[model samples]
Target chain A: MPEKRQMHLGQQLTRAGRWSRAGITSGPAALWLGIFLALPLAAILAISFLTRGEYGGVELPFTFDSYKRLAGFGELGFDSLYPVVLGRSLALGMATAVLCLAAALPLAFFIARLSEKYKGAALTLVVIPFWTNLLIRTYAWQILFSPNRWLTVAAHSLGIGTAGEALYPGTLAVLTGMVCDFLPFMVLPLYASVEKMDWTLAEAAADLGADRWRVFRHALLPQIWPGLGAGFILVFLPATGQFVIPDLLGGAKTAMLGNVIQQQFASSRDWPFGSAIAAVALLLVLVGLAIFQRKGSKHEVLP
Target chain B: MKINTPLLNRHFCAVVFSAFLFAGAAQAEKSTLNLFIWSEYIDPQIVSAFEKQFDCKVNIDLYEDVDSMLAKIQGGGAGLYDVVVPSDNLVPVMMKQNLLAPLRHENIPNLKNLGEKFVSPAYDSKNRFTVAYQWGTVGLLARKTAGQPLPDSWACIFDPAKSAGSFMLIDSVRDQVGAALKYQGHSVNSIIPSELKAARDLCIAAKSRSVGFDGSVGVKNKILAKTAQVGIVYSGEGVRAMVDDTNTTYIIPKEGSVIWVDNLAVLAKAPHRDLAEKFLNFILDARIGAQLSAYTQFATPNQAARAFIKPLDLENHAIYPLPEVTDRLEFLNDLGFKLRLYDEVWTQIKTR
Candidate 1:
């Protein structure tokens, strides 16, 4: 019994040591999030409730007029932002998520299927594009999509409809740019999960007379669901807040919430309203992140 | 043993903490000058010229446009820059906000070289707070070889079928909205909501047809590339484009465009005020002015440098218009609090 107690004490000490190390590692991260993210976010939330100044800065006194303005929109047979910019942001986010998933899945699978020899080369190809500035890549896309440009030129010969002036800046260019920018974000995370997938389970499922699709659905998918969830989170969150691509590729006529927030701060000089809008965007992001966590954990099909 | 242990740990922590503090203090003592200016406007040669002359480290910061520059400056505690080149219209607003340091004109002997016309602009009447570095008017830049008669109006931007999705306009709030207001025969500084609403509508219409709402520099590139047959650009950039690319031509709109002047000002918290003044005076030299003018191809404000301009290029109405043409133009002043209304309207038009 004494020996057992000693063993138990040793186990407890080992666990404590591990916990202490984790606490140390997380200290810098926590401090960073606390200062850079949490503090600014709290200020933004506080300011959003305040009145907007004439020059668009925040007024000293508090006022709920901004929220009340949104409330007034509810009486007009719609949620203030329904069928407006928010709705468009949501629609664009969903389309971008779908597009990113479709592109990322194949690339992740191909990299995962590599015989452990060419994996580094293939993964490097995926990551190397990200090293270049995203805006520069988006601008390169502009050159490609311009009328009579190389991409459109090839499309013309291939009888693709994107040949002429039809390929100019608009929704299509913005969507394509978003897909290109976020594809790697989805792939890297999915690759980590997919590469670690239990190949034996898939083989066992096939051995049991299951077809490829069934094996993929029942065995492979369960192993990679966490990666899919991570990829979805990675792609969905930033796509919702995308600014540069929409500004550069979408033309001035098509703007997102990011553009609106930027205008509020710079052009409007209305930090309060900008902060309010930012607060709302932050809330939406938090809500999204919460839903993502719940869905990710709840749907884990592990044995 | 336990007491000794805590004491030793505390001593070690204090030593490490002191080391970091000392390092940080040492780093802070180094003198540095941070200059924030429009991208490509500050000639790299000038920066190297100053660095070589002064031996004091100069950090050159470039901003894509004025709004981004203002955003950083107004953010308070950015500590990222010491000197800024803001437009003339911004001078009054910055002065009213106490964001600028009063210039010591005596230290800057080149202040005398600035043409009297630039010295007495409404934004800074005495030119005490800011020194005018470069001045240009908003004008039409068209493709010369494309055979489109020089566009003398902002109407071309609003006319879709012709200039649709192939033209550029200044992305700035004052210039973009102000141009629309001028085109509609309304005062550019009108605070009246109805006139603003009209300007907003016209911009929305114009944006629907525009290839891009870009900076003055980008518009200059568009004109050079011939990707855009016409652009609303700075007169200086327009002149440079016409000179560099034979296909490009510039014309001041008959109705008029927003004439802007960029000024060199010391920030209120400028730590290197003496250095800032030295740099300011260096650019004021007539020979330096001539070099900048030759490269940028803008109208030189220095009388001595005016003779350096080729006669044909000087006669180009787009580069240096006749006196009568200059008479019809107006300078943009601080819009004050009305900037918010313009931004809100611009956002509505852009997002919609």
Candidate 2:
């Protein structure tokens, strides 16, 4: 009788746990992800295999010419396009990632060390810039960099003419905007992980006569590895597909992959080519995710 | 589980009810008119007047670019918009796709108010389904010089050494190509590759010199700002700029320029045909036509409206281009599938 009662109680607890987890599942969030992400991705994939209409829209006939064109299968200098665009995108994404990581790390650490009462306020400061539209901010940068603007006047006064010219509408402005926009994405996860850390191990290292550097290296470093890894992935994913910054801040000289794909569909009306480029961008993102997952697992597992 | 059962049922029922309501509303709207056009081109006063006069709802949506408007129409969302404003070149394509309703002249008496000069063009012969709203030519808007010669040819603007990073060209393929063709003393509609190649070469040579490719409005603003000494822009917009700030002067190039006309056409499947016709009639009234021109600062095709304006406004050579200037202009035609070729060349020039 006693054993049977214990089994029934265990079953009830298990059911209650399952119910609680299911209750936390937000219907609106799931629906939003379904409609926006999954539906659009499926539509793009479907359109990519179709032939181009005479007027440059999608036709029903299935063809692989777009992918073949991207591969530069038969044409002269066609193959060069893939590597050129891919190289530029990769360089930009990598630079943005490094900038974001560097800018976010110290800020996140300071937030983690703050009292719980002040932590939210400190974190909110990092996120306030994101509330404003990215395009508006980019345009503001444009205004500041224009020859007629006061920034130019100041630059001339300081003998920084070349730097000011380089700062306005191209690589530098884009990097600045990317770092500003995505730094919060890097910081939040890191703060959460760092705040939840067990400090007892660090104390034990110190009790054993280890110096502060040694204690940090042996005890503190290992715990925060996962957070750093997560922050890196969070910042890297969206930065890879960054569009507005490059379009607004980056001048005509710097055409990112996002700009090219946008032109292919919007102005050029070349769907197959656009889809082919979009497919490449998707594949790059997925590969990045896979690598991040692998790295996370390698560091996180404590056999 | 028991506690949440009603909640789950309520959520499901709410979703089902909302879906049904949306579906019903979509089907119920059988008389709505959807007009998609350029932003700031059409006056809200005109739309409201038509709505009040016709006793029908007027749905006006705006787009930033004409190409984007064409994309939406072509993207199988034709049901989303009933009326669309397309430039002269796109009308034939729209007609070929059977997207337009044949204009019934008897229903629209204001069609007669348009000048004879606008009745026929290269894009649509016989003015089948289109009614000309406003017509303008791409020409040189030069600054008044104390001593320097006023450039009468496109060459002075396209010259690399003289005009690099200082001149403004129209931000469009057809217009840009036309400018290059005009500079070379060739017809704007020349589809000949050798001539096109020459145009492309000229465009490439002018790239380093160009401040940027800008639209008519931007070109006008640049001229007013005195940032751009010369710009290739529509005559009407340039005239408005000159009126706002008197330092600007406009002239049609002696070689040639492209004339562009924006036409108003009703869609074949327009849900609110009665309202659309009423709007057309309202724009056709000479007094209303003059009012619209005043609001939008665009040239009016209504001959009667010209008589109503002051001498200063009428005598502005940019707005009322002289007979010889009008004769020298050519209207752009539908390049058909050759649009892709032109786009590719333009993209290469712009990007490289």
TM-score for each prediction? 0.86, 0.81
lDDT of 2 at B83: 71
Per-residue CA lDDT of candidate 1, range B5-60, in tens?
99999999999999999999875665567898877676678777777787667888
Candidate 2's C-alpha runs over 4 A off are A1-39, A71-83, A148-150, A156-159, A162-167, A197-240, A301-303, B1-33, B140-152, B168-170, B186-198, B219-229
Error of 2 at B28 (Å): 9.5
State the lDDT at B27 in candidate 2: 55
- Most TM-score-accurate candidate: 1
For candidate 2, give the lDDT. Answer: 0.73
Pairs that collide, model 1: A56-A269, A56-A270, A57-A269, A57-A270
Residues A1-303, model 2: lDDT tens digits:
534534443365567666665657765677789999999888888788887666567787788877776664522223354546666777777887788877777777788889989988998898898889877777677667666577767776788556434344446667877887788888888787788777888888899999999887777777887777778777776777677677556534344677667666666667877887798788877887788777666654232
TM-score of chain B of each: 0.84, 0.86
Q: DockQ of each candidate's interface versus the true one?
A: 0.32, 0.21
Candidate 1: Cα lDDT at B281: 86
